[model samples]
Target: MEYRKFGDTIVLRLEVGEEIAESLAALCEKEKLELCQVSGLGAAGQITVGVFDTEKKEYFSREYQGDFEIGSLTGNITRKEGKPYLHLHLVFGNPRQNVCVAGHLNRAVISATAELFVRVLPGSVGRRMDDEVGLNLFQFSQDS
Candidate 1:
């Protein structure tokens, strides 16, 4: 992975064999990023995505292997327990099958390369587990 910072934004190049989510989380930790928005595109050989089952409070995930074009990647970075946390979604286009798959991104391994941008926000946001929602919801204030 290689990156350059411009103002509050970071531009990244993820090389082949790199995992999208893992790379981003590591970058966040190294940069000490508290809050940021992420966007990217690339080619992947393996990817896993999931759909959240709100009723069951669970996630259903499926993995795909073979060449796939990353149509879109979007997500956010925040702090959970003072550590970097990432929440991402991915859209994959399988040209061979002429179909697209999209959902909450679990993992993706770059087959070629990926270009990503991170825009750092001014303030920090924290996440806390919400029992009712069965997920971590953002906590805007310390008291909340």
Candidate 2:
């Protein structure tokens, strides 16, 4: 992966065979990012995405293999117990462009390249696991 920081924004180029989520988390750690917004577009050969089942408090995931285009990728970066936390969602289009899927992104291996943009925020943001929702919700403080 290659990246360049420009003011508050960081542009990243993910090479083929790299896992998207893992790479981003590593970058967050290396950069000491406490809060940020993430967005990207890319081509993937393998990916797993899931829908959250609120009633079950679990995710229903499906894996796809073969060429796919990332139509949209959006999420956030925060901290949990002083550790980097990433939450992302994706919209993918099949090679034929006849099928599309959208959900929380679990895994994505770049087939070609992924161009990602991360905008660092001015304050720190934390996450707390909400038992009722079975998901991590952002926590903000006045000083941050």
Candidate 3:
């Protein structure tokens, strides 16, 4: 993985065999990114995605193997327990099936290359586990 920072924005390049989510987490830690928005596209394989069942408060994930084109990768970075936390969604296009599968990004291995852009925000937002929602939701500050 390679990255360059420009102003408050960062451009990340993921090489073949690299895992997308893992690489981003590493970058977030190394750069100490508190809050940021991310978007990207590329080719990937061995991907797993999940959908949350609100009623059950659980996630159902499915793994896909083979080639896929990353149509979209978007989400945000926040802090959970004072550590960098990532929440991302992905859209994978399978040419062989002529269909696209999308969900909360679980994991993906880069088959070719991926280009991601991260726009860092000034303020930090933390996350708290919402018992009612069963998700780590943003925790905002109340100004005095």
Best by TM-score: 1
The numbered model that scores best in lDDT is: 1
Superposing every Cα of model 2 onto the true structure, what RMSD results? 1.6
Q: Which stretches of candidate 3 lie over 4 Å from their true place?
A: 142-144
Task: Give the clash count for model 2.
Answer: 0
Q: Write the per-residue lDDT of candidate 1 for residues 3-117, one digit (tens) a residue.
A: 9999999999999999998999899989999999999999999999999999999899999999999999999999988988899999999888999999999999999999999
Across 26-105, the per-residue lDDT of candidate 3 in tens digits comes to 99899888899999999997899999999999999999999999999999999888788889999998888999999999
Cand. 1 TM to true fold: 0.97
Query: How do all models score by TM-score?
Result: 0.97, 0.95, 0.95
> Please, what's the RMSD in Å of model 3?
1.9
Top-down lDDT ranking: 1, 2, 3
Q: Model 1, residue 143: displacement in angstroms?
A: 6.6
TM-score of 3: 0.95
1 or 2: which has the higher lDDT?
1
With a 3 Å backbone cut-off (N, CA, C), the pairs that clash in candidate 3 are: none
RMSD of 1: 1.1
Please provide, for model 2 over 49-74, each residue's C-alpha lDDT reduced to its tens digit, 9 standing for 90 to 100. 99999999999999999999999999
Q: Identify the runs in model 1 with alpha carbons over 4 angstroms from their true place.
A: none
Cand. 1 Cα-lDDT: 0.94
